[model samples]
Target: MSLRGPGGERSRWRWLRGLRARLALAISVILVAALGTAFVATYRGTGTQVRNQIDEDLRTDAQLVDSRLPLLRAKPGEIAEAAEEYLDERALFPLSARLFMVRIRGAGNISNLPDLSTAEGDPRLDRDVAGPRRESDESRALRTADLGFSTVRVNDEPLRLYFVQVTRGGRAVAEIGVGESAASVARAQSGVARTFLVAGTVTLLAAIALGFAFATRLSRPLRRMAGTAARVSAGDLSQRIGSTGPQDEVRVLADAFDRMLDRLENAFARQRGFVADASHELRTPLTVIRGQLEVLARQTDVTPDDVRHVDEVVRTEVVRMERLVEDLLLLARADEGELVRPAPLDLAPFVTELFDALTLTADRTFELSDVPPGRLLADEDRIAQVVRNLARNAVEHTGPGGLVRLTVRSLGQGRLEFALEDDGPGIPEEQRDRVFDRFHRTDTARARRTGGAGLGLAIARAIVEAHGGRIYADSSPEGGARVAFALPGFRAAGKRAAKEQAAKS
Candidate 1:
């Protein structure tokens, strides 16, 4: 009942439960059953063939005796003696074929068994006294038939006998019988069985060996992949199957497994970097606040203005820390796909409100493009957050009165595109993609205090992607940084409704 071994470990023969062993066993069993069936059919067929040949030989002997008997033209009383003399002169019977007995029935019964008789109790006994009773019973059974064949036992061994009645002038003259021992049939069948036994056993063993080799070859790649997965589970992310095998389903699976591990390794690396960056970011604000507190604590005499200055410094650092923490939490929830609850949001009004808010926030030459009349399936607050982050980044890069432009358009087939351009030092081509990575700053020389925690673009990317949209950065037509995002699932108004909306705007 309990299959476990000592110390609760699995049994050593558990390998037999693997795919290789099971496949090998299935092949072996199928082959063995086929061989067994063939053996039974061949063995029985051999015995039947040998016995039939013996019967045919017995019939031929009786026919020969019948053909010769009419030529003699002997009376019924002398026919038995004449048949004996004729068979003796010609030596027609074959001893080697086990054609052991001949009986001719006339007025007096005559037998050739005396010449072929063996010792008493022999299996091939052909003497008259040893077989008269059984032979009479067989004769009586076929008395009404002109010709027949039957089996009789001599010393418990089978003998096949053939009998035919001989006639002259439309009158029965005599009856002839020829008998052969069945021993040769038995010997032939036995020899065939022995041969098949050896051949089938050898074939079965070879099949098992070949089956095991094929199964091992087929499963080798899978075993290697399993080993690599085990190593990965043990925290060795560098482990790889590195499959360089043939192009089959197994090879495809191995490649897919390796790709999954590559992604997992990259994710873990990003998580470690994100944590380190967050800690460093939080530490800077805490250090500033702590230093201000320490300075105030050291002074024995402190003015109201001095206390107020420290308070401002502390409050500013705390606010900065709070913003960073909130951004980090938002990114964390985005990873779990729980950041946004979407609804139908009108784009034109949202973009107009955003433009006004941006103009009030900073002194810049803000330009607004034609606002597309459409509704976007998105979280209103989250979309607002993305626009604000992009606007803030653009405003930070540009100087006072520098050009900052915003565009919103509808792409056909239910999609929307938004782009923001600024006239500032554009992001380098090499750093354009990396700028959206958490804590990655395009302007590395800018102080952390002024550049802010480098999570603004990263947060924007996360939120946009969570809404099933994509965000990217490029060079603006104004020769400055350009950031754009596209969102699917937009429902545009009818042409008449769009015209009315544009007139109102």
Candidate 2:
């Protein structure tokens, strides 16, 4: 439920939870992985091709050396001279120089060709010529060592070497190695690696940024929908999420939710209006009935039994009509928002007066405690009526000789609290909330016996809330029901001292 900040621990992995981000990440990983794989494969294959070319050159050089070996053996001193002429005529391509090394089969027969004595040359050839000789039998059929192409240093410059051997009729004759500088190859490979790294880094960063943007786009509509849902749950049925773009699934869902809210708001409005109209319509008839009953009760020459029976019926009907009229008026006033007026008045005197009046009407003893003279900005009459109704309800439900207590206290700030407790069976947990609803009754038989209506608590709630307060019913610490209400308080103006006031006057 708490908000998160970017760069926090959870932020790093936030993208993984979002659908758009996950899809973008999946695409980016596949692209980079495939590209990196292809790059490596191509680079390695090109390197192998270059090396193979060098090997082919080495093989050809070995064959050429073998073909000229008879000529060299017939003229031993002229071998180096012939090698120089051959390299200058055939191997001296642009930026290319072929160096040769020749060694015999003797114990110390290592030798560099006489014409190849310059230090500004391939070191790879010198390395192959100067290193210990390979076993004579291991030489390839063309009398070549088949030394694969490789990079090396020559006079402080990188170079490539290709080595070949010479044999005469199954006996090792000599070794010949050739080499060329490889500065271009090294530069080319370094450029390839750098290019791959730069492109990959830029691509990955762009993918992450784009993924975040898309995720925000997708989450925006959902966040608005969530806000609308919260408002609706809080009883604000006027709110709704507006649709966006075309009629996709999200838009369809939003439209449905808006329609539902509209229905609820209309239903509540109609229900409130009906209650108000019905209460007004029933009041005129009840008034006429009560007046007729009053006239009948005053009739003369009536027998005592007949009088008693007629009086009981009249009283019962009066009580029933009065209860109905009171409930209807409460519902009407609640709908019209006219039940309470905000004003600064003391509540202790009001509660005390109400308890005194109810005590005379009920048999149960009423105890009052902690009745602080707190000032409140509420309708004093409505709050008193609420207190009276709750007291009467408690007294009717309490057993004979049971106790009813009223308590009032300041709740600090601008709030005041009042609670009425009784020694009676508490409301069931499941029915506690429903007890405030209109026409809800827990004891239908008891209500009939006592000539009680079920609208007392419901009316009390409407009146309390109309005063900008709230009421609730819960189990009391006295093993009975406790009904409580809280209202905003106001401070009374202090009285001026008479002496100071006289001086000013």
Per-candidate clashes come to 0, 3
Per-residue alpha-carbon lDDT of candidate 1 for residues 1-505, written as tens digits (9 for 90 to 100):
3554452454566678888789878987897788788878888898889888887777777776666664545675456556656557546544333342333332434444443323323434332334433554333322322357777666666767777767767666666766667878778878988888888778877877888888889889999989998999999999999888899999999999999999999999999999999999999999999999999999999999999999999999999999999999999998988999989988789889988998888999999988777788998889889988988888888899998899887766777888889999888899989988999985542552475689998999998998899999999988899999998878877787666645665
Which number leads on TM-score? 1
In candidate 2, what are the lDDT values of residues 1-505, reduced to their tens digit? 2454645767788656767777677868887888789779867776667666655665676566545555424333244444445555554433233545554433222223332232223443342353343422212111232455556665566656666556555555555666555555555666777877888788777877787677677667776888988988898888878877567777788788889888999989877765765565456457766776676668786677776776677676667777687678778778787777767776657777777888887789788875554467788787888888888878877877788988876555657778899988888888888888775678742445463456788888998888778899998898888999887664422333323323443
In model 2, where do residues sit more than 4 Å from their true spots?
1-32, 53-81, 84-98, 106-159, 181-185, 263-505
In candidate 1, the residue pairs with backbone N, CA or C atoms under 3 Å apart (3 or more residues apart, or in different chains) clash, namely none
Between which residue pairs do clashes occur in model 2?
143-165, 144-165, 414-489
The segments of candidate 1 whose C-alpha lies over 4 angstroms from its true place after superposition are 1-9, 71-74, 90-106, 115-147, 168-173, 293-307, 411-414, 445-448, 489-505
* Residue 359 error, candidate 1, Å: 2.2
Worst 10 residues of 2 by lDDT: 135-144
Q: Which candidate's lDDT is highest? A: 1
Per-residue error (Å), model 2, residue 54? 4.1
lDDT of each: 0.77, 0.66
Candidate 1 has its poorest 10 consecutive residues by lDDT at: 137-146
After the best TM-score superposition of candidate 1, give how far the Cα of residue 375 lies from its true spot, in angstroms.
3.4
After TM-score superposition, the amount by which residue 247's alpha carbon in candidate 1 deviates from its true location, in angstroms, is 1.4
